[model samples]
Target: MQTKGSLVGDLVKGGIAGVAGTWVMGQVTGYMWEHEDPAARQRYEEVTGGKYVPDRTAEKIGQILGLNLSEEQHSMLAQASHWGLGAGVSAAYALLRRRYATADAAQGLLFGLLFWAIVDEGMTPLFGLAEMPQVYPWQAHARGFVGHLVFGVVAETVLDVFDQAS
Candidate 1:
């Protein structure tokens, strides 16, 4: 039988694992964003009528507050939200895993896809921070899909490591 304190400890560990996963995902995304073909970036800009940048956490936050922040500030805010969301998702995953013993790659992939659906395709568009995913260039969408895939995989791996260590 698991103690309440143990459960809470697992949640904290899982959240940290999620942050690690998010950091890895962020690096992959940052590299892709930096090295994407100019033509492809141009196409994205044309379709979105805005700059091509991965992770619109700041934009969504700004939209909610109706504040137009500078580019640097927006980037900072985006990073903060991105990490926070990653941790929250991981913590929730940890709790679910503890209950269901569903700590595997397939589940992680599903979690990532779920996030893509809810946050990327749903909330962002609903809040006017982004257009519907369908409207973006196919390549852009593919990139995002892969990034989330990495996030899920890494998060699950780290969570398992934490479990083993404990």
Candidate 2:
């Protein structure tokens, strides 16, 4: 069992590392999204019976708040959501690490997959922000999986650095 101080250290260190990892993830996914296979969108529509609009979550959030935002605003909101989700996941991971003594990479990978399943496949659809994951093309799914894997690896690396420093 970790003492209270060590637990706090984990929270701080993990949070910092997570945010860093998320930034890296964004950079990676941003490039992939820009260069994504154009045909993937058609496949997604065929599978999901819907259009694949990026950052629909931001639009939904705006609708919920009775606010209308321009394209630029939506883009900003999407960025915010990306960062917020990353930070939130990292913080949760920090706390979870307290109970489990697994290797960082393994734990991070599991966390990434769980986050994808819960957010991409489950919550997004449940909240009407996105179509179910089944509707997405294999290319889209692969891109997301790879992006999250990067996040996990980066997060674990940073966390290890912090652990060593402390």
Candidate 3:
């Protein structure tokens, strides 16, 4: 069991790892998008209306807060929301890892899949933050899955590094 200080340290490390993982995931997905079938990519763009889900989420948040956000503000908020979610989720994952060794069994691959399923395939649509999974092409799902797998692996690796350093 980790002492309180070590747990906090782990959480901080997890947040850093999450940020790193998210950045790498974005790069991977962007590359996939660039190389994707034109037809499928066009279909995805059409279905998504060229707007990012995080942008939609930011807009919705602004509405709830009764604040009218400018386009620039919306974009900034969307970015912040994206990074914040990544960090927050990974921090929670760190806590889980400390409590249950099994959580680290697959070097975070299972956690990544679960995160993708629960957040991407489930909660986003359930909360009206994104379209239903069926609306997207198989390639989109595949890209997301691959990106998340990378995220899991990268996060786990970073956490391992932290462990070794400690």
**lDDT-better candidate, 2 vs 3:** 3
How well is each residue in 20-103 modelled by candidate 1, as lDDT tens digits? 888898788778878888888788888777632234657766777999899888878877776888898888888877777556
Off by over 4 Å in 2: 1-9, 30-38, 41-54
Give the top-scoring candidate (TM-score): 3
Among the numbered candidates, top lDDT falls to 3
Over 1-114, each residue of candidate 3 has an lDDT whose tens digit, in order, gives 232347778889889989988999999999999999999999999988887779888988999999999989999999998988888888888877787645343858987888
Lowest summed lDDT across 10 adjacent residues in model 1 is found at 51-60
Measured on C-alpha atoms, candidate 1 has an lDDT of: 0.77
Model 3 ranges with Cα > 4 A deviation: 1-5, 102-105
Error of 1 at 153 (Å): 0.6
